[model samples]
Structures are given as structure tokens and as C-alpha cells.
Target: MSRAAEAAIAASYKALKEDFVSNLTGGEIGEINYVTAVAPVALVLWSALQTRQSFFKPYTPLSFAVDFLLNVCAILLATTLYSSTPIVLNILLLAPVAIIYALPRPPLSKKPKVPPPKTKDADAENPLPKKPFLTIYRGAMLVVTCLAILAVDFRIFPRRFAKVENWGTSLMDVGVGSFVFSAGVVAARPILKEQLAGKSTALSTRLYKSIRHSLPLLVLGFIRLYSVKGLDYAEHVTEYGVHWNFFFTLGFLPPFLALFQTAFAYIPSYAGLAILLGSVYQVALEFTTLKAYILTAPRTNLFSQNREGIFSFFGYLAIFLAGQSTGMFVLPRKLSSTATTGTEQRKRLVLTLGAWSGFWIALFMLTTNYKYGLALSVSRRLANLPYVLWISAFNSTQILCFCLVETFFFPGVYKATTAKEEKEAYELATSRVLEAYNRNGLFVFLVANLGTGIVNMTVKTLDVGSRGAMGILGVYGGLITALAVGLDLYGISIKM
Candidate 1:
């Protein structure tokens, strides 16, 4: 009860404080966890190593580097700054990315990539491509959105704004919506092409394939539900569902689009139907007052929450149609063929597409104003008329801008004249790191979902600070990127 006793107690208190500070600042996120990222990172690291000197095409070093840097900055900004940065900075950073992309792409100096050897599923008619940066944009949006949602769900970010009634209210909402929208467009490409080409897109074949693809997604969804419900992970029912089969809906949606394509072959274009049907469906939802029901009621499961999958499918399908139509316009052209005749073809194509994009943007603004903002939300759950229009307009403009850059101003995706040309083209133009991520996006998405669950369980995400949060996201994103790149290097992809 004297000086020695008092000193002992003071020392114990100091040690405890040190430990608490360590846990907060230097827990699981203190260092880059290489184990978590795996072989995919290694594969990308190798590719990145080769391109470390320069990512630009061999001849046009400065412009290519600038464009690539701008693109990376935009994606990085979207990833780290969306929730934190000023609105003006977001506009300033993003506008230039779009402008750089909008500038005409320069002529290809290298040879083109050979189309993958023909398989049963290959489309041999048209070739030549730039990086599938749009899907990269979509998937990156999904990845970023999911990461932010995890921040909230794991209590790394506070739960102050997680609203149930707000339609596409958060980045979380847009994240899930972008994934669905991108999938719809990419998944339906072949069928849409078949329809346009007047080929017989057999329903039986597509139907069977749909069921096969949906099965895995359905299984994965169940696994996710179990992980959340069975494990003591943070609850995020509305992100997708409490027990709703969200993946099942995604799997089922594309096949439905394919079947619809067969039946509605008379419909002139995917874009027309997207704008028309999306608008009408949204009007119906509003007129019937069904929109409100769908938004608020589904608290427990899929339908209990106002026919969640059933109703949202209509809006999403419209997005899918719009995506398909956009793909038709942007993806089908051989940029080399068009760009060979100076910038006239390139400029004209850009103007025409840009005009169309402007038309859609105007349509979006008009609808939003007239509907009094009812149609403005990019809500994943509602996916109403406004949401479809918003995404379509944005995507259309992005495609126009990106194509212009690739076709006229930049020369990253060179056209192949022969097999040798294609091989050389890939070696010269490919950002194996980015290309890898873009190609295996679905797999990367699945990995991110699983990784999120694992991280929450193993680490005290709630204990993480802002620096640690960035570290966690960086590690997770890097892991997914690495894996996707690795799979691509192995000539594998998870298309379904």
C-alpha cells in the first residue's frame, strides 16, 4: 500500500493503453498481406514488370501514357475518393478522363490480336477490339461499391445512411445495379448479334444454357446467405437480400433476354426497345403505385420485400437491352478498317454516336424533370425507367468517348492482319494486368464477395481506421485483380 504498489498499478495501466492503441492502428491491416492476394497478383506483377518502363504503344509514347494515366486516375478516384472527395474534384478528375477518351484514337502501329481459336461459341464475323474498358468500368464500379458497402456492413464505416426506402440511394445500390446492367449487356451480346444477323438463335439451346449458368450463381448465393446468416457476420439483407436468391435472378435474366430476342426479332434495335420498354415499365410502376410497394415491403425475403426480383427484373432487362444495343454499335466496328481512311470515318462515327449519346442524355434529363425525380434514382431494387436511362446515357457516352480515343487518338488496341500480327499485337498493346481483370470480372467479383466475408470474420474491421480501411480495400482489390489476371494467363475464364 505504498510507493511500490502504486507504481505497479500505473505500469499496468500504461501497458493496457499501448495495447489498445496497437489494436486500433496496427491490427490485421498493418501490412500488405501477400497470402491474401495469391498467384493472380504474381502473374499481374510479372506483366506489370515488363511494362514498368512504359505502358504506352511503342511509337506514341507520350499520348498513350497520358491516356492510360488518366484512365487509372479516374478508376482510382472512383475507388478511393467517391465517398470522401469533393464533388468538384470528382467532376474535374472524371471530365478529363472522358475528354481524353473522347479524343480520336491514333492509328495502330502494331498488328492486331488474333481472335481466340474458334470454338462452338465463337463469333467469327467481326473482330478488332480495344481494351474492354467499359466492362472494366462496370466491374470496377461493382468492386468499389461492394467495398464501400462492406465498410458499412462490417462497421468500418458507420451505418448512419443505410436506407431501406431510398432507391439506388447509395453507392451500394449503384454497385449492384452496375453489375447487373453490365452482365445483361455482355451476356446478351451473342443472342442479340444472332438476331441482328438473321441467324436462328435456338431457344432450347439458350434456355438449357441459362439453367446451367444460373445453377452456380444460385449455389453461390446460398453459400453467401449461409455465411452471413450462419456465421456472425454483419447483416446486409438489402444489399441483395436477407434470404433472397439474387444471383438466381441474375442468371435467369440473361436467358430471358435471349428468349425474348427470338420472339421479338421484329423489334428493330436493342437501344429502341431499351428506351421504349424501360420508360413504359417505369410509367406503369408509377401509375399503379406499385413502385412504393416494391421499395418498402420486402423487408425479410425476395417477394416479402415487394416482389423484389420479379419487379426489378423489368427495369434491369431494359438496362440489359440498352447495353446490348450499345454493344452492337460500339463493339461491332473494326476500328482499323474505319480509321484507315484518315480521321473522317473516325470523326463521323464519333459524332454520330456522340449525337446519339446526347439524345439519350437529353431523354434522361427530360424524363427526370417531367417525372419529378421519381425516375431519377439508380436504385438496384427499383431499376425503374430513370435508372435505365441514366445508366444507358452514361454508358453510351463512355463508349463513344472511349472508342474515339482508341480509334482516333490512341493506338493501344492495334488491328491484326494475320495470326502473326495478332500475336504481336497482344504482346505490344496488352496491359495484361488490366486486361486480366476485365476478362475474368465475374470470377473476380465472386472472389471479392468471398474475400469480404473472410476479412470480416478474421479481422476486426470495426477496429480499422481510415488508413487501414484504404489498405484493406487495396489488398482486396489487388487480390481480385491478380487472380483474374492469372486465370486469363492460363487461358481460363468464368463466362457464366
Candidate 2:
């Protein structure tokens, strides 16, 4: 080979090596960005097709335009991993491109709002039930208390025994376990209420309610307990720690949401304050020795590795709460004439802010020497202030982008056969995204965990060559994605 060709080959090998190391170490962005980015594109394309006018014939041109732009932007951002320039520059270049493509242009003409089908009519008077403040406060207390018990357990027991044997199993135990427990109790509420003929029955009802309400609390405890255990187990098991950390965290989400709704009723600005406080807390934590201290002795202090600690839990809660709050804020508002008039303009504004914020946050995270290992460290908790801030900012930006796409670009995507269909689709999408969150999200995550475990036990065990490994990964990933997409399309089945 020529000298130049040899140098080129060597450089390519070096990049591949870095990528491999990053993936093994959990440093690389991996397939997450692609999956998330693709979902919205698909939704938008569907919307375009569903809404096309009869006169327009095939809307292939517009579909192709949107798809081309979305793919191009996604490629640019994904490939920028190999670039030497700062992440800020990459974000700057990529965000605008994505936003521009995503901005909703008016349909050739305004189609009259199709009155929802008679069978699909929402009961205007029924309304969603009001969430109560006491419920949220009590749930929070339960989570805190459980975490406290786990902390005590950790201190008393040997580290190895204290942890769960299988992270995936632990997640299944906690995540699915909580859902089953909660659902069973909730389902029996009417029977339990009828049996309340006396004070004793009343007392039983109260106790049952508390357990039902705090199911999320129990799930959170299991997640923390087992996640830490999974990390330890990974030292031996390597590939299949059977860890479903995300599911464990998410199992608590529905109750958490219920609680937040109740709390928000009392303190309307609480959502905003949560976001502000979380952001500030994260930023402060990042710039100090706080990060190092967290890793060194996470269990020694109240704020240490405890996932349900006020600081860490609330920080993530802020994200979830913010998402819910935004939905609540938008759902009731009749789109004003001004909003409709400036749809394109407002979209540009949100996109601009999202892009700008995303740039700075991405830059900050990449530059920081934070370890990107696959094993989640309770001690080296990235849930600390800086990591929290970065993830929060990124999450918020993405949510905003998602909302804009839904609002302007894909308005009718969720309009299915009935009101229930619409409601379910929205819920499922939100749940899927939340499943990917670091804390307090459950259902879709069980799918991820089981998928990971199956992959590890099967294809991952093969002594494949590089090409073979790539092929295995491709097939495995394709199958998993297809299965997930199918389940999502068919309606998420929350398995216990």
C-alpha cells in the first residue's frame, strides 16, 4: 500500500478503536439519538400523509422533502462524533438544520377542523380527576423512607450481598412487581370499599390506599438496591448483569405524575421552580468537588448515592414534572388567533432557543472529564448538579422540539379512531420517552431490559469476527427495534 493509504488506514483504525472503547465504556452516544430522532420523523411523515388533500395526488414530494431534511440533519449530528471541533459547533450547525426542517409550514390551505367522530367524542364534563397534594407528599415521603431503609441495609450488610444478584431480574422484580402490586390493589378498591362496613374496614381501606399509593415508593427502593447490585455483578457477569435499572426507576413514574399533578394544583409555579432549582443545583454541583465527593462515598451522606434523596430525586422529578406541566399548560388553551397566525414564527423561536441551549449544554458536558463508563455509579452519581443540569437542559430542549413538531408539524398524528385512541397514543409515546429517562419511568423499559438480556445470552455469546459481530449487532438491533415499534403500534402491553 502507498504511504498515504497506510496513514489513512491507520487513522480509520484509530477512530474505530476509540468508538469501540467508547461503546464498551458507555461513553459513546450509541444508537439512542438515532432511535429518538427517527421516531419523530416517522410521526411527522405519517401526519403529512394523513392530512394530504385529495387534489394533491400523492404527497410524495413533501414526504421526501421532510424525510430528506430530517435524515440529513440526523446524519450530520451523528457523524460529528468523529470530528475534532467542539460539540458546541456541531450542535450549532446541526440544531438549526433540524429546526428548519421540522418547522411546520401551513398546508396548501387550511383544512377545516374535522369534528371528531361521534363515537370518539370526549366527555367535556367528565374531565380528568383532580390530583391531591397530600397524595404527592405522602408518596414522596414513602420514597424517601424506603431509600433510608436501603441506605441502612447497605451500611449493615456486606457490599456484595447488599446488592441484588441480577440487575435485570431486580428491575423486573421492582418494575413489574410494583405495577402488579399497585394494579391489584387499585383494582380491588371497589370491593375493599364495599367491605368497609365498620371502622375496622375503614381502617383497612386507608391502609390499602396507602400501599396502593406508595407502590411507586417500593419500586424506587428495588431499583436503587438492584442497580447498585447489578454494577457489582457486572464485574463477574460482564455482559448480562440482567439489569433493568431504567424500568425500576420508571415503575414509580405514574404515581409520581399523579402526585405532581396534585401538588401543582396547590402551587401552580412549583413546576417552574422545580426546573429552575434543578438547573441551578446541577450547575453548582458540577463546578465543585461535589462530583468527586459523590463518587468516593455515595452512601456515607444523606445526599450520597441515594436515588430518592431530596436533591437527586427532585432534580429528575423536575424534568418529569416539567413535561407534565407543559402538557397541562397547552392542553386547555384554545389556540389564540395570534398563535395560529404566528405558528411558523413561534416555531422558529422555540427551535432557536432549543438549539442555542442545546449547543452550550452539549459543549459543557463533552469538555468536562466526566467518566462515561457503562456501569452506573451511585457513588460517582452523574445525577449531581452538573450532570443533572446538562441532562436536564438537553431533555428540556428535546421535549420542546418534540412539542413543536407535534404542534405545528404533526398536529394530527395522534388523532386515531377514538378519544381513547388519541389519549393512549399520547400516553404511550410519552411513556416510551420516559422509559429512556434515568429515573422514575417503567413499562417500556422492561422491554429494553429483556431485550438486552436476550441479546447478551444469545448473539453476544458468539465468538464472532469483527464483521460477524457487526452483522450480529445489526440483526439484533433491527429485530429489537422492530419488536418495539410493533408493540408500540399495537398499543403498549404493560406486562407484570
Candidate 3:
């Protein structure tokens, strides 16, 4: 073979080898979720820019042109992930955090609207109002976040984004895990509430239910693994087996933690359990040859496929337990927090999240530096203390920023930017948009996955340049988003 061909072959082999160790050495990005992090603020800010007349009415030619241009800008900004320096991405993504607080808000009403007197029965039954806006926002975030993460994974974006980079880099792969985990955390809201209400949540019963719930995923994961073999596109063999976000981590978490909660209700906090579990893993690594076992036997049993999907469950379950513990503290305050002024409730929530973020940051540093620690970068596979702390810190901080945008910042911007008489119509449009997005988040997620697969099949992604790849992603994402919104508006909800 020619010398040039040998070098090329060597490069391909190195790339293949990297597929195995990418999680270890990919150099994780801290702001991996920058696109997701900025979305809530962007959505609200965009809504604020709408006029009452145009909000309720269909957009005119000029308005449509302007919105289209701005949306294209947004899409490129989100997907290209190109920056001369990491700090540029940081400043661009973090701009909203600073800018939101600076926007002028409407003055408080001279006559504060009085609530009807709480009768004894009314006080007894304080019904939670249906928060359409928040619901829509979550759905949108899920769809958009899922799309962006998948795009990077498919090599539709910059290569650096598919792995970890500096803290402020947009859409790190590790950060993607946190985004997925956050949804799981949110989904546990009801379970957390049940535990807090002093309900008897037996581990056995929870385990049985979790098994039933996870059975479909068990079937699907195997099927997906098998089906992708003949396809000419990229496929991560381990990803479906144990590495996918929705697989082993989620499968074992509920029942495993329920067992712990059942046995240890006497304990005051999840912190103790987290430390104990982490220590056990750390010690086991010192004493055992499990790493060798995993590398040698890829699919030996149901428990440890890809070595990580199973082992990471311990760390993920810890995260879930911590989430429930957090719910115990956070949900009650959220329920009782009534805002007299726009910022009051939001201020309280942000402060709480900020405190938790700081705590997690400190824990991450301490744990990561544990002599055995600084050697490893943050890992989604292991889901260890450093990984857990890094995700928690970022998720808390970003979610707080999102809350600020939704609660005080965007609302203020809306009022200040629009006339008082147009308020009702503007609200109506925002509500409708939110409801549309909220109604079919799962549908859109599936749609995006399907679209991604189809696009890969239809086009030579390796032959495509960054700009072309981004354009493809844009059209694909736009189509899915539009279809989802349209179907939802027509009251077509494809529920699981």
C-alpha cells in the first residue's frame, strides 16, 4: 500500500478506537446545554416582541419576513456551534441572563386586585390553576433540546459539540445527559409528592411497576440495536445497549431507590445514601476487576451490557433519590409561593436554586479532587460523584435562569414592549403557542428521531460541510416543529 493510504487507514483506526474512550477523554464542555439553557428566555422574549393586533391576527408579509430572518438567525446560532474562542460562545449564550434583568417592566397597578375572601371550604381546597404557559414551555424545551442533542450526535454540528469541552461551550454530550435526566427528575414530581404526603410506597410494589413500565424499553433497545446494523449511517453499538439516556439508568432507578427509601425512611437525607453509594463504587474499583470484566464481555448478561448502562445506574439512582429529596423541599415552597409583585416568588425560587447549585458545585470539586478523582473527567457512563455534581450544579443554575426568564424577566419585557390595551390578545397568542408545544412533546421527539434517521439515509453527511449540514438540520427541525404545532392546534394528541 502507498504511504499516504497507510496514514489514512491509521487515522480511521484511531477514530474507531476513540469511539471506545471518548467518554473518558472527550474533554467535556460545561455549557453543553447552552441552546437549551437559553430557550426559555428566547421563547418568552420572542413572545414579548409580538403586537396584540399581530399576535391574534396572522402575520403580515413584512412581519413574516422579519420573524423568518430572526428565526433563521436563532437556528444558526444554536446549531453551528462555531466560535473563534470558547468565551465567545459563553458570552453569546449567557447574554440573556444579564439582559433579561435589565429590561424595563410596567409599573404596578395603583389599585391592587383583591382576591375573593377565602371561605373555609375554599381554603380547604386550594385548587392549582392549569399553567398552560409553563406546560408549553417544557414541551418546547424537550423537543428543541432533544433535537439539538441528536443533531450533534449525528455529526450535523461541530465535532467538539458531540463531546465535552470547556464549561461554557454549547451543547456538550455530558450536558445532554443532564438535560435528559432533568426530564426524569420532573417526571418524578408526582412520586415525590406522594412520598412527601406520607403515603406508603413499598419497594416491592414500586419495583413490580417499574419492571412492567420498562419492559417496552427493554424490547425496543434490543430491537434498535439489531436494526441499525445494515444501515450505512453512523451507529454507536453501545449506545442502544446500555448507553442511551432512556435505558438502564432510568430502568433501574425507580425500583432500586424505592427499595432504599423503603429500608431507610428512618434516615433524614439522601446525602448520606449518595455518599455511601459513591464510596462503595470507589472502593469496589480499588478492590475489583469489574472494568476488565466489562471490556472482555460486552453482552454477557442483562445486568452489565456496555459495562456502563448498568453500573451508571447506581449513580443515576442516587441522582433520582436526590431529586425526590429536592422535590420534598422545593415543591412545597413552589405551591405556597404566591406573588404579590412579579419578582417575589421568582426571586425566592432563584435564590433556592442558586443555593443548591452552589452546594453541588462545591461537592463536585471536593469529590472530583479526591486523590482518585482529578484523574477522570466528568463521565456520563460512570455517573459518579463528579459527574453527578457537575450536572446538578449546571441544571440547577440554568433552570433558575429559566425561571427568571419565565416569571419576571419576559413578562416585564412583554408589558414594557407592548401597549396595555393589547395585553389580553398577546396573552392569548402566547397561551395558544405554549399549549401547542406542550400538547405533543413526545410526538415531536419521535418525529425528530425519525427525521434524523431519514436524513442520514438520504444524504451523505460525511460529504456535507458545516453550513450545509446546518441547513439540513434547520429544515428538518422546522418541519417537525410545524407539524407538531399544527396537529396539536387541531386537538390531535398522540398520547402514550
Per-residue accuracy of model 2 over 1-496 as CA lDDT, tens digit each: 3566445545654564355433232222323333234434433433343333221233245533443233222222222221223244334434544544466654665669986556634323312211111112122212212222222121221132122321111111121222222232123233323423332334445455645755764675575457557644222221111232433344444454444434544666533644565556655555544433332322433333342333334444554454343333233212233443234434544564466457535643553435752222211123333333334344444445455555553333223334565454343223221121212213333444444444444543334444554344335333433444345446565433
TM-score versus the correct structure, for each prediction: 0.70, 0.45, 0.71
Between prediction 2 and prediction 3, the one with superior TM-score is: 3
lDDT of model number 2: 0.36
**Steric clash count of candidate 2:** 15
Compose the digit string of candidate 1's lDDT tens values, residues 307-378. 666777787778777777656655543324546532444566677678878987888777766355433434
lDDT of 3 by residue, 131-247 (tens): 323453455455545556446644546665554321122345444455444554454566655755778766778788767866655655554455455454465444334334454
Ranking of models by TM-score = 3, 1, 2
Cα lDDT, model 1, residue 406 = 44
lDDT of candidate 1 at residue 94, scale 0 to 100: 37
Best by TM-score: 3
Name the regions of candidate 1 deviating beyond 4 angstroms.
Answer: 1-164, 192-198, 238-241, 298-302, 334-345, 370-378, 412-430
Please give the TM-score that candidate 2 achieves against the real structure. 0.45
Pick by lDDT: 2 or 3, better one: 3
**Model 3 residue 316 CA deviation in Å:** 2.5
Whole-model Cα lDDT of every candidate shown, in order: 0.54, 0.36, 0.52
Better of 1 and 3 by lDDT: 1
Off by over 4 Å in 2: 1-248, 251-266, 276-293, 298-311, 333-382, 403-441, 458-466, 485-492
